[model samples]
Target: MKYLVGVLLALIVFNASAQEEGGLKRPDIPGELMVDVGFNVWTSMPGGLERRTWSSKSIGIYYTKRKAFSSKLSFNYGIGLGLEKMSLGDSSTLASAVLDDNGTTSTDDDFVQSVLIVANPESFSKNKLATTYLDIPVEFRFHPLGTEDGEGLFIGAGGIVGLRLNAHTKWKYDNNGETVREKTSGKFNLNSFRYGYQIRAGFRGVHFFYKRYVSDVFKDPFPSGESPVMTTVGINVTGF
Candidate 1:
C-alpha cells in the first residue's frame, strides 16, 4: 500500500512537471470529463439465513480521452474516483440461561426443585447502520464516432478497485429497562476489485448508462460463504 501511494505521488509530480513545461494545450479532438451520481443495490449471493439488501448512493468524476490509433479502430481511456455508502442487514440472536435455586428461584420445601431456562433465541433490535467507501476505476472505452463532434452512442466495460474508507455499526439495546446507544467498529475488506460492463446512449455531453458487476467484491474465505452483486443505472455528463 505504501509503495502504491509512493508511485501515485511520483506520477502526479511527473505530470505536473510535464504540464508546467508545455502549458495547457486543449486538443481539437472530441472527448470529455464526466461527473456521475447513482445508487447501489447490494445483496448476498448465497442467500443467508436472512436475505439482506441495502441501498447506497455514489458519485464519480472521470476524465476521458478518445483517439483513433488506426483508421478503423479507436479507444477511450478514463480514470475516475468514486465515493459510496455501504450498509448491512439489521438482525440479532437471542438466548436464555438458567437461574440457581438456592440463591434466587429457591423454594422453602425440599419436595420439589425448580430451575429457569431460555425460550426465544432469534431476535434483533433495529438501529442506524451504514458504511463508506472510496473507489477508483480505470477503463478502456470503445465508441463508433471518429474525430468529429459527438454524434452517436458508445459502450464501456472496465475494472474498478476500491478501498474501505470508514465503517461503523450503530444500534439501540435495552439494559436494565434503559435504552443505550451501542457502536461497534466494522471491519470490511480493506480492498476490493470488480469488473463491470456498461451500456450508454446519448448525444453531446449527456448519456444514460446501466452497469453491473461481474466479479465478487468479497475476498478470501468469504466469511459469509456467499457472493454479492451490485448493479446501477445512472447518467454520465460527458461527450463520448
Candidate 2:
C-alpha cells in the first residue's frame, strides 16, 4: 500500500517539476482533475442474502487526473473514497459487537421474522449492513472537442483498485417515544483488497459509471452459500 502511494506521489511530483522547469504551459494539454459522485446497486447476489435483503444502496466519489493525449483523447486516473450499504429484509438489529459471530438470525418456523430476542424489531424503521473503501481509479478518456474549451462529451474505460476501510451495521429506532440510533464498526469478514473494471461517460464533467469488484466481499470461513461480491453502477455528477 505504501509503495503504491509512494510511486504515485513521486510521479505527480516529477510531472509538476517538469512543467515548472519548462515554464508555463497550457492547462488543457497538461492535465485535468475530477471527482466522481454516484450510487451503487449490488448484482449477482446469492440466495442466502435474498431472504433477508431489502433495498441495497451505495454512495461513491473519486478524485482523478486526466492528461490529454490529443484534442479528443486523454488518460484519466486518481484516488477517492466511498461508502455502501445493504439493507437486510429482517428488521431485527444485529445482536453482537463489531465482528462477533454471535449475531444469530431471528427467523424460525414457530417465531415470526418481525420479532427478535436481541432487539425490539418493531421499534426500528431501518437497519443495514455497511462498508467503506479507499479507492485508486484509472481510465482512458476521449473528449470530443477538447477540454480546454467549455462543455463537451467525454468517454472513458478503465478500472479501480480499492482497499477495504471498514464494515459495520447501523440502525435507527424509536425507544419509547424517542429516537435511538447506533452504529457498529468492524470488518465483518470483508477482504482487505478489492479491484474491478468499469466504463465511464458524461457531458460537461457530469459522468456515469459501472464497475464490479473482482474480489469476493468476504474472506475465507464466511458462512456457506453466500456470494456477496458486489457490482456497482452510478454517476459522477461533476468534476474539479
Candidate 3:
C-alpha cells in the first residue's frame, strides 16, 4: 500500500509538471531532441599569427514543450558534452619567442604563448589545449507561420552555460617521415565556464543555427595588455 501511494504521488508530480508553465512535456512522437555537431574556425586574432584552426564538436539532446496558450511559442532545455581541439600555427616568429608557462621557462621552440608584448608564444598559436565541458541550454522558440494544421518556419534564440571538466595539449611533429606525439601541460583558462548564444531558423524538425561566443577562452586576453575576440560558424544537426 505504501509503494502504491508513492507511485501515485510521483505520477501526480510528473503530470502537474508537464502541464505547468515550467516542466517537461508529454511523451509524444512529434517532439524534437536536437543533437548538434559542427566545427569552429577562428577568424582573426588580437596580435596576428595565422594558425590552422581545428575541429571542435559538441553533442546535446533537448526536450521541448509547446505551450497551450500559444502553440507558436515554446521552451526547450537539455544537457550535453562538448570537446574543443586546437592546434597552433607553425611559424618561425612563434617558434623563436620565449614563453613563460606559469613561471616556467620553456625553450622547446613550440610553446604557444597565451601572453603578449612581454615575451610569450605568438598570440594565435599559444596553448593548444583540448578542453571538455558539461553544457546546459535554455531556449525560447517562436513559430510564426505554421499553425497546428500545417508546416511553418520557426526561430529559436537562447544561450548555453557550460562547466569545464578536463584539458590537455598534444604536440605533433614529423620524425624521419614518421609522426611523433608529445604531451605538454595544456595550461589554459578553459574559462572554468563556456557558453554562447544562438539564432536558429527552420521548418518542422530541421533548422539552421548560428551560435556566437560571449565568453573569453582565457581570463586574460593578452599578456601584453590587449583584448582578443574569437568567433565561429556552425550548424545544428537536429535543427529547430
- Tens digit of lDDT per residue, candidate 3, span 124-181? 2233445666777777777775456223677878987778777666555555666556
Q: List the residue pairs that clash in candidate 3.
A: 112-126, 113-121, 113-126
For residue 133, model 1's alpha carbon misses the true position, in angstroms, by 5.8
Clashing pairs for model 2 are 52-89
Ranking by lDDT: 2, 3, 1
- Candidate 1 lDDT by residue in tens digits, 53-145: 334555566666665554324555566555444433344311112235453533433212211111222323444334444455554445566
Error of 1 at 1 (Å): 24
lDDT of 1: 0.48
Best by TM-score: 2
Alpha carbon lDDT of residue 217, candidate 1?
48
Candidates 1 and 2 compared: the better one by TM-score is 2
RMSDs, each prediction? 12.1, 9.0, 10.9
Runs with alpha carbons beyond 4 Å of true place in candidate 2: 1-35, 44-55, 92-124, 144-151, 173-180
Candidate no. 3 TM-score: 0.62
**For model 1, the run of ten residues with the poorest summed lDDT:** 111-120
